[model samples]
Target chain A: MLSVAEIINLLNSIPVGYKSPEDNCFNAANQMYIPEYKKLGVITVANELQDNLPEADENDLFCDVPGCQIAFENSASYQAHFYNVHRYLCSVCRRCLPTAHLLCLHILECHDSYFIIRAKRGDAMYSCFLGECKVKLPTPKQRREHCINKHKFPANYRFEQLCGKPYKRHTKKPSKSVEANEIVDDMDVVADIPNMK
Target chain B: MEVDPDEPKTSPSTSRSPTQHIRDRNRQVAQQHREEQRAKTIDTVRFGLGEVQEEVEELDELSEQDINGLITRITRRKHASAEEMHKLSEAFLQSMDNIKLFFEAPGALQVIVKEIIGLDSGCQVGALECLCNLSLGEAPVCEKIIHQGGRNLVQCLDSPDERLKRTSLWIIANTISTSPKAAQTVVQMNIVPKLFYIYLDDSGEKNIANEFREDAAVCLQILVMGKNRAARQEDITFIKDNMIKKCRNSVAAEYHLKIIFHADIVNPRNEFNIEQTHHLMDFILGNLYTTPDFGSIANRLRIVYAIRVLSNMVQCVPTTTIDAMRQQLRGVWETHLEVLLNKVFDFGEDLLSLEVVYLIRNLIHDKSPQPLPCQLDRLEVPNIDYEKLLPQEWK
Candidate 1:
């Protein structure tokens, strides 16, 4: 990730003058603070360096599916795998790929169930962001709208669709492992109920 | 015209006096006697007939210099004086005869012909006239013109006066008619842009009859039809907005429609791309039947031709890009297909009519789930509703 000073140096390299130094500084800061830099490059570096972390050797690679040994070539390849295997979407058209920018825009602008869709499409199984709805929406838009409209927590809701997931500010969000077991139990009950009927 | 009386009158010898007939007979007998002797002494007199013929043939093979010399003499004496002008006019007329003579003997004056022809403004017209003549025949002059700074002729296109512009274009059109390479050269020089500029700036200024405007438009119409990609994108844009729109909207003449269709065929939009030509064709196909009034017969025919050329060109383009475009323009195709069909058949035996059929046939035939045309199985029906076409789902 680029530092604020490095970003400032980049901005200074440009020939045009900004209205004020404060505005330039803020813009430069915002540009450097992308989720890709934080999650993919910076945080991993920090975690690995802090204690010579045990998981440092495993950090360089990711397999398409859990327990599968085939290594993904890059982030884009991993993203493509999620799309091709799980969602069956067109990459260029942004059919069902979650991280695809154009598709995300389409979901946010056009769809009504953006929040539930987003959480369901994430790597982990989780409870609904809204207090009332338990339905798994496919995208971030559904999750966001559900939190704002259903929960009515305007101030606490953070709807940064690019990187940040919609989370309730006051709640202790359950980890993926716990949520996964809960999801399995719920699926079992639904399956059992269907048989009983 | 003055008739010279110094020449012999045309009549039978029998009408003349017997004395005159006797003298003519005696002269013929004496000429025969001399010919018989000359024929008998073949070894002495005719020793080099074959060699002389060969040498003459060789000289005839290289007579371009002689022609240039004749032309130079005329140009040097500028014909500033009335007597000189008359003499020069006489030489010019004689040069016409000389042109006929030298042109027949191959290679006579072939080398410096372009330079000689291009020598002066006065001589350029004559040179152009000769070029036009050479083009009309199967003379190798067109090849020479192309290689010998032929595109330099386009410098004449800059005339501010409408008549000169019209004439230069006419000359270019004539010169290019017999030479595809010449036509290609004209296109490479960006003649379309210059002609478009002239058409827009001069068309309505003088209240010239639609006849004159049509003539000017015809020049532009041909230049656009030439499909010159060497033309700058900015010129293409200007032509699309100003010249094309003006032609479509103008009440002065239907000939302007030819200009619009031709311009559309070449650039389609101001922006340059391979698809720009296809888009223009698609636009015309859409507009031809959709417009409330289809304009005149010539204009309609031109529009049909544009469609045909566009469709032919489309077949050569990559399937993937066309498919993407088809998906993008599904609405355009659906709404306009019927209208295009109604008028597409008007072009008979022309490729443009066939192109229209292909466009319509492909549109109706392509049956992809996605709105675009693809290499996959053809669609029997395309579902195009503008409202439902927007992105409906996201994940």
Candidate 2:
């Protein structure tokens, strides 16, 4: 995983190729090799690190689904995990996504109604922009459509952001532009700031 | 379900000889009755509190006004006595109203937090006690402490002072018990695993290094004493009805069906995310039965809160999580069966015994018991008389 610069810097810690080892240097004071430790220890460590790190082949990838612990041989196998095992059903929507990538995107674009509106269904419900909506929709797609068509919300009118990002996990970028009604300008704290006419 | 005399008359028993047959019937009926009684009372085992009672930590009492007066005095004074601080700290848990009063005061929390880091052992212990008691039964105060990076409170667990370490862990544990939000926060700070590791480190010279003359595992055990009283309906409604205005997640929200059940509207980010919910499930699955051997009264009290917190958590879980957890639940279910087999039969504490039923009932839904991270085949066949214990409608 070390970049070219990192490798060079690590190599530079070896005193043999350059000059005498620094007196107070960490590499000089303590390293695995006592025989020319500054040079040998650093080189040995770098070699061991490279050798020990699992290459991006057999065991490099894993299924990121919360509980599925199987590792993959390659990216193709990793992608196959979704189709083979994980059903990719959103808890709210109940629609099955074809792939893990699409599943992530579907949750982002659809699941919005965050409140348990009435006694019609279960005691509690899920929502995206939790308290803002009056009536809660059961599915993510319905909630997203409700926000845009019923509420007359702009295409890119985000329900909310968490930790400066959109409410849900980011998967792929939107295929089409989510045109905002108006530009948000330089202000960062959107909650406190009033809408500009 | 309706039994008829005709059915009994038609049976082979009517045609059989009397004495040996009568004895066999009596034996069968008696065994059946005994089995039914055992099944009905298994989870409801309540140990005699006096018999298994461990020492509850003592806190010198303080009045409601005395709490505020003490804080104000601490803030105003350049130096304070250890005795006075300890008394004040003990007094903090005495009243929820006073905790609210102290928190509502500006800079009081920061001042008390500063005292925790001071050189004076009395002030440190007192401040830690106040902080710990502040966590008991008060969600808002717990949230405040959790929000302020847990007041660097978790770091105090590493303190050489045993009183300081115990109090710190207790405070953190108490905070987690207040709400899922508080638990999520402390767990995120990456202390949940630390507690597990602390419990694991019971051998070697390191044991002698511990200052409390207490067991190394006690801090972790105390941390999971479960949800504070605030989550209880009576306590929650009492607070809601008495207050002049409704909190965003108060009783009104429950009626209205709000998503962020534990979040304040003004500060919405404080609620648990799905990942945090996963973390809670993970924590419970792994640590729920970490208490010392069963039948220990102290251990019984510890798991009550642990299971209660789990009950509160799964209340918010969606169906998908249940599906995902189904496979991993087998191991947890095995542990649950193991614990129940060992400790629960003689479980005599009323609260502990009662909470077990609540825990089991909460796990079941409709006809199918969801993957509750536990399995119970002992009571699979229904023989107990529900009508005897339950109401007419429940029956």
Candidate 3:
């Protein structure tokens, strides 16, 4: 059902003389008239206004995730989508954000997602990092920090650099330091210089 | 060949039934008899010199029918077996007189040398030994044998079998020693490293390996000493840096010093590291008495070259540089001078008399701050058993 404000906003967008009795489809509560359509009352004018309003852009109405592109086909559908998909109810906008908000939050909160070592299995996903490393975030930045601190990957940005293969991704880990004896002996040609010392 | 009673009878009068069985049994018996005859003929044919010579003449003078029969007989003798091949090469060497005639027989000896080297059998050693003796005796023909498929000898140097490599080194050394001109072809082939590796491999004290090392060192020493200055420079540096120093990596220090006794000590100007030259001298003086006199010529000449070069260098280099040379040679002068002096006075009695007199004359004539006199207290004269000594004034 259209809210009172949405109905009024739709009517205000049109010129005064555009509606007629035959143009009315939905029976609206409020009506207005101009000289061109005096016979048309609230139902005709409201339906004409509803039909004249431009369609909402698909991207603007839908959340960014793959399956939610047509979540808000109607006001009731939008409400149900927010309630069911996002489980979020926005008090100020009078909009329920459910699964759609879940996706938006996933994207916003974890910038480090790009660096997350993920293995996509059909519709499901799993983290490939070894050992008790179950953590998820929306963006690559947060996920990268999470990987470095939690997973013992190299904390440096170089470790996070892409390996240029999608299947074999990076979870940044620190390289071990050269052994003391090896530094002194096998690396004589490389480390013996005064600068290296 | 006594007939066995068990032999199947194939006569038409006997056994009409199972004729196929009887025929099969007869064929097996005939085949066994033929095999025994072949083994016997291979054993009896003499490959010795007079016999082989007669055979060669026969080969040359035979009627076409006789030649066919001779080929058929030799074909029956399998040269593939180790015992057969060894005996055959021994026979070939015994028939060394006939080998000379085959030199002109288009690839005869080359084929034999190649076959010897090519086979899995151990006849290569005997075959090479025969070639070594022949080359040493007949200098003119060594090049032909070596040039015609003698390169298989070098390939033997890289063989994983140490014995094969050792024998190859000996044959190659003997081949080069037979004629100095052969060194050009041998060096062009870059065989210097292979020879050095075998000379340095200490895995075997086996007589063959030891002999190979000694003979090769001696031959390389002489070849490097050839009067060609460019060859001398390249060859000497090659021996010092590549062969002598590389041996240190594989050989015991003592054995390293032992092989160092073989390095050629030709024109030693400023080419070698002065310190290395001193170290080499010390090695020579250490082995002067201990090393056998026959193979020690290269070591002896190396020492003399060091002494002569040090002597000559003082006159050429500035006074400041002379101090460095002296510092480098301090090890030799301190440690081994007395032993070298003894060898000079003793075994070199006959050889050094005229050279020493000439050296003394040059010493008196060529004076540049008079190079330090060979210190007397550091010298010891060993007994000169084989060499004749000069008179007191001449000494």
Candidate 4:
């Protein structure tokens, strides 16, 4: 147990963190290591060494997959869950992963993420990058091949970011003034930005 | 709430087929029956007079002499049965006004407090149990219990007996939950520091005995829970929307929420202010005593609970809350950040680690604060990829 004096020393050692950072993405200027953090580092090392404590009985909690009949303790729950749940199941190849946490990683690295559509039914099912398109392929390259050969969808339309649900593109409204201007060769300043296209 | 720390590891004695054991069971039941009857009589005499249903309302109806007499009669007994005390305290809770009257009675509180500190662990635990039961939500009674030398409940925290420590911590938590005033009173007693001191007294492995520390965290939660603007916002909404749903036409929820949180709705007995978040931080950090868990799993749960309480405090406080808290102490954010990320890396899918991340995010980025949600909602990720959403710069 940390003694009163040691605890005081520890507290005194750690600088109160930066109150705020102005930079958006991430500012490494805000991150710093101190002696207190090293103490925490020691704690983590000890945590790893002492990590073998028996787990609490979680047999009662079922997998979060909707309609899943698997309680955590069910013999096949862990082993069969990949195929049991679509989130863990690679839709085209039918390969399964163990956990939802890993499923995203697996799909991103292995499967066809091009048609990245989420079918939120019993378990999360990742589809080909061209959302709502019927062509389900084992890999992104396969989906791209199928899209090129079979579908007339735009090349950019067939592509989507694979991670963190990529980005949701809401419908864009054509402005009435812009529509009238479109009768002419409308030059918008916003369109001048290369990425705006 | 789920862990029944009091439950025996082994089942109570049971045997069928043996006549001797059957007789022993019968005898024990009969003895218990006699005690219950005695407890019932004592309860009836003190509060059952002048219409039993209104006995709670009419507790002060007992002459001072009668109250004193009842106190003397109950105190003189060498061993007060815990069941009987539970029964009496349960009855006392019904008319909390009478509980105040009972405690305020010439010498009754002193007797109970004395017995609580007495050498007999059973008596001490029993008194704490009765007190905890009596003051569960009754603010006035709880206030009286704490101010009337009941703050001495801290003594029980130091006792060698685990049962006594548990019950005493529970009683302190119960009173703290009574209202913001009770919370302020308990915290002002430097309860957070005192508890940490006792918790680390063993000075061995940094394991916080869950039986004790979990409740200690709970007490800290109470100290901070209803004190913040969000809690008050939620409180006002709850009181108006749910507390007096039927009485909406008659009594405004705002009036009631203010009245209840401020003190008694009708009779604002004592002005009770919620303990400030900065003040709590001072206690938590200044007296922040801890034993190194050196990494025990049980200790991990304790850390999770402790961080949860801290996160709750963070959620309750405003952005300026951290600024004020930082004036008093530094390193809460970074210290927690290290511990939190470490746990997250060590134990993926840890809900507590997720909360700590948010707290760190809030502290690090100074994000525009959102309205605090209910406690359970805090555990879930805003989206499944919340982990991926974390800054890539994070180690």
Candidate 5:
């Protein structure tokens, strides 16, 4: 319920010209924002990129998984499919497990170091990895004991070190010649861990 | 009372006997029969025809003179039955000639407006529909309605009947869409907030239908997007104050953004000034990450809407203005770019991924005179692994 005069005032209050930037990312010598390809110092390569994906259908919901091409009639059906078939797909490692129980085990055994880091950062990391289980613990020791008793993890398994490493399932050929720094190495779990308490 | 031996005896507190039950049932049946006969008689008198189906056919075949006659009848007999008014309204909707005749007849607009204001909710809905159809006539017809019955039209928006409210909104939308003058006149009546309330108000006895809210949205769009600068200014101000500043409802904000998006799309000459555009961009970018429950369906839709609005705004503005805004709001842009890039690979939802891709496309392939450095550096085409990024099955 604004008065006409108030509305006019509000519209007038909007500044017309842009304010001067506190910190500018552009060089003062270059007035134009030049593209990287067109820069004088940069070397150019003619790479022909092809869009190989099919156009999306508005009426159907397509699964977003890399190799899954399943289409669902509605979000409900899609959600059901996601929970039934893809819920056990690990977010960190992308490994598909046979059951929620096995997925929980895999996460604990393979991603223990990541969980420890998250716990030290004060995140709520002690919740059961099984989607249906709502049990949460405040301390790492209590979480370990609960998992052993409830989820049947090995009683003597090492929880302080990362036991498994993620491997690249699919690799893309570099459009340009690869640089030395562009190559990614496997995670060095031992280098990351200090003295284990 | 004394009971005879031949008659079946019943206790005072017990249920009625079979004989009494049968007698009562007979009376109820006879009462139903009487009510049905009365209704049939009323229908016959209302249409002045034996059957309603026949009357509808006759209405369709109405000539110009017949249409005039209908208007004259409405003018003389202000208390026309709902069925008669409905038939006339439907006839007007079917033929443009009837609508022309409606405006050609003297005092036709006033008569209908009076009917809308004076009649019961049933008759008001019919009259409002007729007025709505008539508003779709030539520019003068819409103008005349705005000058003559504009208040009544706005009043109909406050009616309790959902259909009446819906038809009234449809009529206003039609009127405003006719011409800028008509739109400005309707805006002067200060009905924009009422439309916003209808669309955004959640406290109601029953859930308002989505169709009704959609009609309100369309009306708001027409007003804000119309060539009438005054109307656009007022509507945008109301949206800024209510939907943007308070941030009451995310869904409503989405609708408001949609109105702006459509305005940008239809009027590509940059209807929004720099300041308004800056405010909108900030609001949209802020909401992109601030959804209360991040991964729900509704929030996902809101994100899609935000992306579309950003894309359209970027396209509508000039290159220099974009460069200036980019310099002024570099941090906001950088954060949103990161969010958009992340959403592109969020494998849980395909629709969201597609919209993010479109926004990114707009950013990189913008029609600027020179490619923005931020866009060039952020995209990093050579670094992205296509096989790992997109679906493997597609390749």
Candidate 6:
């Protein structure tokens, strides 16, 4: 279980979203627990929200990131170097997230509407967790087939249904109120949970 | 009608007869009629002059009243409706004197600019048109418009209404055309990118009319083509960085290349760095190699622009840069030169042939160590029919 101080710290770091900070932390943790949501893919978000990556100079082709002494003669090589050497990308939204923890935070803050709509539909969501593959299937059989045929995942790879019930249960809560008393109530509930991670 | 003294001697042969008496009486009657006719003509002239003088005085008073009314209407705190503003703009367009009077009014430009920013799109279009006419006045008037509301005019370039955008571009074009100082003032406002975006509206939707694009292109050309060195440099840099760099491969490449060519004519010596020179060489060479459909006038024009840009690059770009580019693009250059020579000798487009000839001349004059792809000495000059090439009036 998270200590009170740790929960308070997590609450302070929640970024732009409609949910309370505690709820955001809870949702981010839940998203992190799902394996398929951790895979990175092409960015499909707004350019404004994309990681502020520096562009390679047309002639010089040098990385402008601080403390990096890397350079290349061509743009393609420079792009490849940057892609491989730096930055973690959010798998669900394909946004570049700086760290694993921020990726978790981004998932909950940015994809709240997606999760809510899915939970409202009460449908099972299956996605390929393999390298940069964003294929989502409706059933375990199709997912397993996709993983085996497309990604070359071993047949014995265990496929679990990604989170559907947790979002559905949370959907019933009244999300409009962010009163202090309600947050304390949330804190109490969070404290009661045995496995915080 | 008066009897001459010599008439009596000529008539001495004829005795004082009844015929002479009748002639004298008849002549006196004719003289009396003539006097009456002259008196009538004088009276008519005096009457017409009086009417014309009165009408002129009335017209002067009416025009003065009309100008004052227009100035008052424009300077009002409350914005004029679209119809009223349109009528006022039309009235101002009738004469430069009215435009002068309207602008000379206290706070008239400020009020019009306010209406442009604060009114509905329809009204804003009218106000913009009014400003467009106002900018068509003397240089001082254009300077006043730029000093008063240049930023608002630039903002109107982004208006959703096509007329509003076009009128804004027209105003800017007029302002820049008046004097270099006015053009520099407008350039300092950072309007190049806005005008360029309007020119190259890449959005698949045809929201921007061709006329608006033409006006925007004119404004951009004037801004870059001005003799003001600082303003031209600012505008050229904006076009190179924001427009040309972003849309080098798009369909608008021809237009961007034309702007660069025009800007290059007034370019300061050795302003382009080595990298920029190389980039330009590659771009110009690439366009030169790309064959266009000769049947399409638009495509032919694109080639003309490309060749002209290549000529500018040859002339203005540093010698070392040119040498390096020549070495790197030798094969492409050879093909391009062959195509240009063929166009000159065979295609018979007077303008295109002339530009190619100029490009060849520039190449020869550069005098690099490497030999030109084609032999100028062996090449036969095509006999161009000057009469056929001349314009109809010239012919």
TM-score of chain A of 5: 0.25
What lDDT tens digits, residue by residue, belong to model 1 across residues B41-140? 3311111111323322321222446555544554454322222222222222233343354345433323223332131222333343333333333224
- Candidate lDDT scores, in order, read 0.37, 0.41, 0.39, 0.40, 0.51, 0.50
Score residue A47 of candidate 2 by CA lDDT: 18
lDDT of 6: 0.50
Superposition error at A84 for model 5 (Å): 56
The C-alpha TM-scores of every prediction are: 0.33, 0.32, 0.42, 0.31, 0.43, 0.47
Query: Scored by Cα lDDT, where does model 2 land?
Result: 0.41
The residue ranges of model 5 lying beyond 4 angstroms of the native Cα positions read A1-197, B1-60, B204-210, B226-235, B245-253, B260-305, B308-336, B339-395
List the candidate numbers ranked by lDDT, top first.
5, 6, 2, 4, 3, 1
Considering the two chains of model 6, state its CAPRI-style docking category: incorrect
On the 0 to 100 scale, the lDDT of residue A81 in model 1 is 40
lDDT of 3 by residue, B1-395 (tens): 99898765555534556867556546544654454334323322323223444444422233334423332433454233333233333333433343354344444454356444332223444455445434533455667656653555655555444344554565565556556656555664446655655566566544521345554554454345333411334544555675335432233333343233223332223354555554543443444434444234344444343333333333333343344534534644453333444455554443342222222222223243446434433443222321232223222
Runs in model 6 lying further than 4 Å from the true structure: A1-197, B1-64, B74-78, B160-162, B197-201, B205-213, B229-235, B246-253, B265-305, B315-336, B345-355, B377-380, B384-395
Alpha carbon lDDT at B58, candidate 4 = 33
Candidate 5 residue-pair clash tally: 0
Query: Superposing all C-alpha atoms, what RMSD in Å does each candidate have to the true structure?
Result: 40.6, 33.8, 44.2, 31.9, 31.5, 34.4
Best by TM-score: 6
Candidates sorted by TM-score, best first: 6, 5, 3, 1, 2, 4
Model 5: which residue pairs collide?
A: none
True contacts kept of each: 0.00, 0.00, 0.00, 0.01, 0.00, 0.00
- For model 3, the stretches where C-alpha displacement exceeds 4 angstroms are A1-197, B1-84, B116-119, B123-130, B133-137, B202-210, B228-233, B243-269, B284-350, B353-366, B369-395
TM-score, candidate number 1: 0.33
TM-score of 6: 0.47
Q: Residue B211 of model 6: what lDDT?
A: 53
